[model samples]
Target: MSVTGERLKALREARGWTQEEVARRLNVSRAAVGHWERGKNEPSYDTLIRLARLYNTSTAYLIGETDDPSPLSAAQGRKRPRSVPPAGWGRLTDRQKEYVRRVTDEMREIMVKELLDGEQ
Candidate 1:
């Protein structure tokens, strides 16, 4: 198998996930996962990002750039940039604002973590 394929197989096996399980998580066909593991095909950029996220590793490691499988940004200890409140957020009542902001912040953190954790 190709280096990328070998790593992909190894990572999936390490996770104790079946090919069908990986495919289900990725919203792809089991055959597609097989193709990736066999090196008959390579995942797209976006798919690679998803795989790296699911595997808790870096695309750099998946694609054979670096051997270190730790996350790219977390390993570097980069600080998250401050996020601005959403537009029209001040129109809410004080209590409403607090509740909404908390939920918004939580959702934003998930999005930011996903974007930051995966290389574009």
Candidate 2:
């Protein structure tokens, strides 16, 4: 595969995103991602920039000029929380957990309805 194709595949896999997921983020079809990875075609310059931004890397790194492609290199080798919880929410009792779950579900439904209605 070409350097561009190899780098694209590596970056996408590093982020644990499937081709379809990457395609959705880039507003392209999964086939386009597959083709790019397979070197059947190349993305335009604008798409290349979009890919780098989405993957949090530089365009030069995406094209395989540098091994350390991550834009977060400054924070590299530092320990960080696996998953940070929202502020103001400590560990919850069983009752509180249930209540929060219900409220979250209700809010999700309301937001989804609003979004779908707006689309129509």
Candidate 3:
């Protein structure tokens, strides 16, 4: 089995869940779960996030990007994955969003400076 498929199956089995059960919980088809576990297809980005959350693991781990199983929340104070915007972002005012963008840019600059300093 592929790394992702193996990981997915292991996580679900570790939870003592059937593929059908996982499908029901994720609001997807049982065949979809089967496809994932069999490595026939991959889940979409949003579905991948939901799957990671459901399995209580990180997408990086699930996708073989990292061995770390730590959730994104464990990286507190770290910038969130750009694909997943901050909560309630859509509800924010345009001016508030702009302010947030500026803050994020400032934080990125600070992080870059810190990394450079550490290297020196």
For each candidate, the alpha-carbon lDDT, in order, equals 0.73, 0.68, 0.74
- lDDT (tens digit, per residue) of candidate 3 on 1-120: 556789999999999999999999999999999998897886765677688889988765676645667764422554558788665668766854664566456546655786778789
Tens-place lDDT digits, model 1, residues 1-120: 655688899999998999999999999999999999998987876687789889988665776545678876644753333475444546655854554445435545665887777976
Clashing pairs in 1: none
Q: Give the runs in model 3 whose Cα sits over 4 Å from its true position.
A: 74-120
Candidate 2 C-alpha lDDT tens digits along 1-120:
756789899889988999999999999999999998987886766687689779887654555434567652322432224265333337544644454445435534654676678789
Whose TM-score is greatest here? 1
Error of 2 at 116 (Å): 40
lDDT of 2: 0.68
Q: What TM-score would you give candidate 1 relative to the actual structure? A: 0.63
User: Candidate 2: lDDT of 47?
Assistant: 83
lDDT-wise, the better of 1 and 2 is 1
The clash count for each model shown is: 0, 0, 0
The regions of model 2 sitting more than 4 angstroms off are: 72-120
